[model samples]
Target: MKLLMTTAVSALVVLGSTAAMADIKLGASLSASGPAAFLGDPEAKTIEMMVDQINEAGGINGEKIDLVLYDDGGDPNKARTFATRLVEDDEVVAIIGGSTTGTTMSILSVAEDAEVPFISLAGAIQIIDPVRRWVFKTPHTDRMACEKIFSDMQQKGITKIGMISGTDGFGASMQAQCKDVAPKYAIEILADETYGPQDADMTPQLTKIRNTDGVQAILNPGFGQGPAIVTRNKAQLGIDLPLYESHGVASDGFIKLAGAAAAEGVRLPGTALLVAAILPDSDPQKPVVTAYKAAYEAKYGETVSTFGGYAHDAVDLMTNAMKTGGSDPAAIRDALEATQGYVGTTGIYSFSPEDHLGLDLSAFKMLEIRDGGWTLID
Candidate 1:
């Protein structure tokens, strides 16, 4: 009887320790490889950095954050599996990531069934559709981006436009938004071309656009070297129409890959995090943006991208909620959904029951790449 009692006491102690250590276990699913590797690479780094920062700052509720990450390699099946493993096997208190729309959507059912709080890096409006009680987002939706872009185009008097999009989640999302809202802006879409993600040449698409009439501007929404292809092709084919790119195409690599001449006079909508240098001092995100930029440069010795900004916001918001709400997934979700005026690297996030996109037109600004630098257009 004595031996049995002693064994039971030891088991209780083990259980108590496990419960105590469950303050906040966060999981992430990101595309750390495949064609979209660049998007998730910075995301992984930013999450690591934010984890360190949170832990060093006395953690949340006096407990440390254990961030478990998985590389989805831009595969939907891989994302679902990673999310399941994080929740069931690791017993993470909350979940973050799904760097792309499709990857995030792949794990929604798992997250909803398991009652885990999910914050996705993807900005598809459909990501938050049906409003999974556990899911939230950090990036502006493609619809929001299109609205902002079209508004800016209206300001610049760009009525007739052409579009080239890849057959990927990000591209498809933007293309749908552009098509849905074109009539409202009175913008005539002359040519809409689609390309595969792995396609090497876009010259044929540009050739089609060049033949179209009344195409004063071109909107190319894609990533993974697609922007470079479009720009280079446009220049090679001597098409000098004003080119407008999506935020996905607003990377330094695109400018480099497209060559300086090819990248000239291109415009795109970018989150404040990408052009924080030009943001006013009174901006709520100035400090966080400043700190993130400095820390990222110190660690990687490279410039930050929209991917990094969105990733940092995703981790920071989740960590803050976990800190305030303990390990209760429901409580964390409420806290995240209740988020208002919370400033992060991306922008000021204020989510409500009716709106989950976080920010509005003010969160984005028109930016042009000139002389190898970002110039905020007035």
Candidate 2:
């Protein structure tokens, strides 16, 4: 992970490029500063770190990457402006963003019209449907997580469940998917409740579910402050039913924010970011994960979360496509569409015109917090 003196200086030079045509311009619009800032902060940091590493390793196709970042503040209007600026003013060949569904959804049309490639860190499946040829995604969709959660629950002989979702785009989409797929697994949802994104308490919602007759477990399809609050209140209110989180709550930060007593025994699907410490040796992505972890921890002094892993993979995938396609948007789109077995910080990404999401349900593992750390449960 040590960078040579020449490589480090060259990397600085590459990052300093201001002209549109000087190097490979990559634009990213994320919630860099907002209520959801933690989500995008890691993503931005990972991009910076990965760009430095790639540049240090002789750059991509001998043209260094010039990554441009914007803080959308989790606002749709701001995201649109940033996306437009990147495509029109900054003249970036492609865009990479790690905001939630609401912001990313607003920027999609602009990216499509500009005919620039966009790789998203958000997990809403609707973003890729109708499949914008210029758009790609690295995060596991909410529907995929719903499938995994319901399947895993069935395997564990849990059928009666209660639902709690945040009143946000990501939470809404996940809730709908859970409703649609719940019947498929013969799971009965006894009660459904909702809380606002910034709400500091979910005791009322949990109380309603706990009072319901047949609810045996709670399904929390929320993230950020919502999940943290729900976890805290669930323990304080003495809700003894098992708690299942959506894939959005994969970071160690969730455990820290939610508190050990509340976060304990919580089950959720494992993102590639969560398994760096326990990846199978035969996994093709082991080396890349190892290298990314070492360098990221060395620079930042902590573990990389799922958001960071997704952003890192986004750049790696786009860079690989650019290298293969030689900076042409159409060719890069085709190249990305044809990707297969792309080992990255996220899972091995393989995209096609028909299936933009490369990884399957098996890509996730079950995780629980035990002894103040993430432990794979299944």
Candidate 3:
């Protein structure tokens, strides 16, 4: 009886040890079914697909990644709730989601309090402006998008412009950033108009912009269907001025939503993923983006978007960090901050104590919609 008891005890101990070292918990909160679903759905899909691939090939350091994913439905409150659950209940070592700025902000305090490494997929300057200790992000900031557009406008001799933006978090943030930086690029905002996220028609606002004095072009800083509506409205109103959109709408869905004919001649700052096929072979991001695009399209049977690329980079960053940082949250944070020269689908990433986003204006490609496809412009 004593020998039997000893063997049972030994078996239990071994099982416990094996379970402890078998998997690393990673959490994600995305808006997979709401207005921002266009952004979140792809993000969630990419993370899941990447996790599966990693586990299939032998996850980081031989431990499988146990992904705990939740769809916040684009609600900030739900995002907070899911983030809390991830840190406290699931005990995830790191989090790799946030699909929107509002959702990212909602999860910030929760992750910070738990000291978990959080890598956001949202594109807001404020996400990393002050530089939170435990937070990092993959997408380029709204400010960067604004600057890129402004630079393009300056080159085109479009000094005076009108703005139509949404009142949502991303739209409002990009509008403010654009307004703040317009002067630096020798551009003037002659008119400004705002619309609600669900507003079916922006014709009234677009009319106002069209009638504004000295308005050489129109810039729309919004996402979802709002920008699409604006694009259609501009066409209906016979507004011939050059139309520029923010990076928030840098997805194929936008083109389809706005209709290819309406989206033609529209320009936006976007990542290389949008124009992967035409990118020069010498371009460093060509192979990386092509591989990711091919893998994603093959697995999902849908076109790739910049939003998915953000999640791809986020997963890449976290998994690479884990290789050196192990499962410890703080060590992972350090490894992430120390990351340098890592080529990704979006751009080359090099994180530091001062800047968590790790990319500059060069990461963006000014793309114009032509013949129902993206055309890279100088």
TM per prediction: 0.91, 0.90, 0.91
lDDT of 3: 0.92
Model 2: residues >4 Å from true position, as ranges? 1-21
Better of 2 and 3 by lDDT: 3
lDDT of 3 by residue, 20-54 (tens): 43379999999999988988999999999999999
User: Over 4 Å off in model 3, which ranges?
Assistant: 1-22
Clashing pairs in 2: none
Model 3 error, position 71 (Å): 1.7
Candidate 2 per-residue C-alpha lDDT over 6-124 given as tens digits, one digit per residue, 9 for 90 to 100: 89977856764545564788889989788767778888888888888888988888988888899999888999998998888788888999478888888898989999988888888
Per candidate, the number of residue pairs that clash is 0, 0, 0
lDDT of each: 0.84, 0.85, 0.92
Which residue pairs show backbone clashes in model 3?
A: none
Tens-digit per-residue lDDT, 251-361, candidate 1? 677788888888888888887777778778987778888889989989989989888999888887887777677678898888888888888776788888876657777
Per-residue lDDT value at 339 in model 3: 99
Report the candidate with higher TM-score, 1 versus 3.
Answer: 3
TM-score: model 2 vs. ground truth: 0.90
Q: By summed lDDT, which 10 consecutive residues of candidate 1 come out lowest?
A: 15-24
TM-score of 3: 0.91
Q: Point out where model 1 deviates above 4 Å.
A: 1-22
Worst 10 residues of 3 by lDDT: 13-22
